[model samples]
Target: MKANKASVEFAKKVSKGTPYKFTIDTLIVDHPLKKVTLSMGESFSYIPFRVEQVPRYNNWYHELLGRRFRNYTVFIESLGKEIHELIPNIYRGESVPLDLFRLSKPLKIKQPIVRNLSKASSYRGGLSNRNIALWHSHGWYYENTQDRWKWQRPRLFTTVEDIWSMGFVVPYITPMLENAGAYCFLPRERDTQKHEIIIDSEGSTKGSVYLEKGDGFKDEEGSGYAMKVPFLVEGENPFQMGKSRRMPVSKETFSTISFIPDIPEEGEYAVYISYKSHEDHVTDAHYTVHHSGGKTSFLVNQTMGGGTWIYLGTFRFNKGYDQAKAMIELANQSDETGQWVSADAVKLGGGMGNVIRG
Candidate 1:
């Protein structure tokens, strides 16, 4: 007779809208012929929102969903019935005893994703002081000159991209996050293209910090790289405040721009960088981040996804004014020569405080 052992491992921090993936490994010593069937049942204090939104014909669809899921137990039982039908071998099991596992301390750092749970319940979780920037793609645009409403994007078989995002975010996601104790802000007031969303001022971004090239950057003497003056894109300006600095790609000189952030406290923060995307932009833009743990480097593709805040990774930093404590540097050097490298804004922390959007 042989014994079998198994282990499950996952990260402690979870992001909202992001899946929490875990791995389970098992070892059956000296029992190759033996078979094991694992039946797992997990439960949380609250029911998680469905990943996919229901196709709604009217307002009644959302109301029905809320009513049906009002009772967590009933909802789980109903879900279990569907699962049982799919797999006959699976059977409902008793709830796992809590004492069997050792619970850890509550999370000490700011979480990117805020879980939506019942506020009236005994749970002390709340976001009373939190500020959330609620952004959706787009919807319909009204041309005052034409005096008619038109779709911003092409209509799909299911729904329009902008309309779907606006519908899902406004009616559902926004309210849930608000109920959980967050103060939400809508960046997109109307579907007009003239309305621009800019977060340059300190008050707008809360405690987060942003750095631009001319403001908090300098290049090496005789770097041999031509710097492009700040300019706004006629159609879609990806740069922050409709401006950014770019340099010609060169193999001769590695001209770099350092972004030093003033850390308010010692904690982990999500770093974001924005750039103007163009066809001549380099495919690989080298970036190095110096944090509390160590230095990490990343090669970003500047050819695509410009004008948006791209997440680098979460890193721990010390509280201080010193650049050694926390800094990000980007070099105008890459393997590709004919392309150009951009330097725009670097953001520390989430739009509000040290938290990030999950």
Candidate 2:
């Protein structure tokens, strides 16, 4: 089969105020083709499935080295998320964790959610020429420090040599093409280039990291999960990065996470917040998302989601000393201890997404 070209369909609408509901449509392409639905695929540690939950610990213990590395067998057994079926190469599959829906800001669709998954551009019968399928898989392992997983990435994956590594598979995951199959990387660059401003919540060597459980509120152990978790450097972190974790963000004279505006002064921009519960401890965390437009408050059970970028709301703000900075405040009174209450990172649309009048 000589293959080339694919398409993806996704949609999002304004929610309440600045927040929006974003969802990708599920397409059915029964026959096998050369298609692949890649997501955060650029990420070495990016797992295809969503992280459901983690075991909890009291008093926040510190691990200098990192999580212990379990043997391949042991690690696979403890894998919490299930391996979902691939969208098949007859040519269509996109995103991770199958059905994915979250609070997202309005933005134009940049790349095809679906793409050709076959390693060979042309295949006939059981024989073909060229293996172009991408050989990829990732998950958490014993990094012995903060980084839980070692990561398996195909460097020359797009070049050659990677044809050997393309066949590696896990328990539940099925190969989109046959093992020893050749697949090529299809480039989907139709979307316009995006400009984004990311504020790392953890203490950044670049500046004062947005670290806060609450003011003057330090736990007994004095160990801080915020300081330990890796910074949001190109979406890389040992522990899950973003928002404040295990700290009570006091509403009074305090915000969970904050960052100053660096460009274009201020205007109408879509707002986004990234944070997730790490372990079994699930608390209904309350938040008042503040931006240039105004304040929108809501409640969320952080435990429900692993690490994710959530749409809080959108707004218009002016550029000033403290005016342009974005902030997420923890408002849940019941969440007194801030145990597992996390606030990691925040994002401004930088003039992306859709702007509905409703």
Candidate 3:
């Protein structure tokens, strides 16, 4: 049968709402001497479905299915739905619902401490001094052997606090911005909608970059052909040597462009619009390209690897200081180790730097 004809027939059968028995049979009607009989084996019994039942079958029936039976349901469901809707159905089948299929044991996601180095500064001021004071208050001393004060001993900081902050920031900020996305680690952008924002490494001299568009964005440009965004390379430089720019996306045309910039200087790089909205100030979203070969130690908890530590800064939200203090207190109360210190101790410069005299 023609593929299109078979598809039409399949759709008609699904929409008819009639129960049918699917069977397999081997023909043995004409035998040489003795007549043979053929036996039929039932494969599946399809139940007639109501229109209202379509939604339940589409949603909950997959829960009862295993990998072996999922494809069969998908094929039947696909006949009655658009391709895009069916795609989600396929994804639902692939994912095991945690609430429904609980594991025999529990799982834990460990939290770690992360520091941001991009905001570090060389100027000596209140922020830097406050961090030093806080560090000292926690029994951590500053070593001036390298002409810069470095943390000399283990310091008291909450890894869980850092992770919690990142979890909030990533999810909250990612969905808020237009075409805004975030990754635990940077990814290479193959293509994106014309208006969609993407982050990728600068292409190499020998390599080429291109953008792909979907069918919904046809007739985007004067030419009907899909648009291409190319990254030009000169000599050995991989980084782009021009001002940053944004591309436009129309209702009819959606496409992405690619380019190669001069190879980065062995460090992380991030591309983000500083402004939250057109009216907002530009915020810096960072990306790390090469993290190797540096004297600075990198700590990554929730936000991807920031930068090497240079100068630490501290900011106080006076308006919310009391609430912040209370929250920290609640967090410490739940900590297993009684050693957890109150935020007030650090805020007052006494909890971290206790100089005991004999």
Model 1 Cα shift for residue 58 (angstroms): 41
Looking at candidate 3, the ten consecutive residues that score lowest on lDDT are 341-350
- By lDDT, who's the top model here? 1
Total clashes in model 1, counting residue pairs 3 or more apart in sequence or in different chains: 1
Q: Candidate 2 has what TM-score?
A: 0.33
lDDT (Cα, tens digit) per residue for candidate 3, span 1-358: 2223333333344445445443323323232433222222332223433334445543432333333334443323223322223232223343322233333343231322223434353323222212111111222234545554444343347332323433443345322321121122212221111122122222222222222223221211111111123432234211112112222223222332222222212222222211011111111211121212222222223121222111111122121112211111101111122111111000110012122221
Deviation in angstroms for 271 in model 2?
2.0
Looking at model 2, which ten-residue stretch has the lowest summed lDDT?
A: 53-62
CA lDDT, every model vs. true structure? 0.49, 0.36, 0.25
Q: What is the TM-score of each candidate against the true structure?
A: 0.36, 0.33, 0.17
Assess the local accuracy of residue 57 in candidate 1 as a C-alpha lDDT between 0 and 100.
Answer: 12
Better candidate number, 1 or 2, judged by TM-score: 1
Off by over 4 Å in 2: 1-194, 203-244, 248-263, 278-282, 323-325, 335-339, 350-358
- lDDT by residue (193-238, candidate 1, tens digit) is 2211122322222333445442323332211211123333344233
Better of 1 and 3 by TM-score: 1
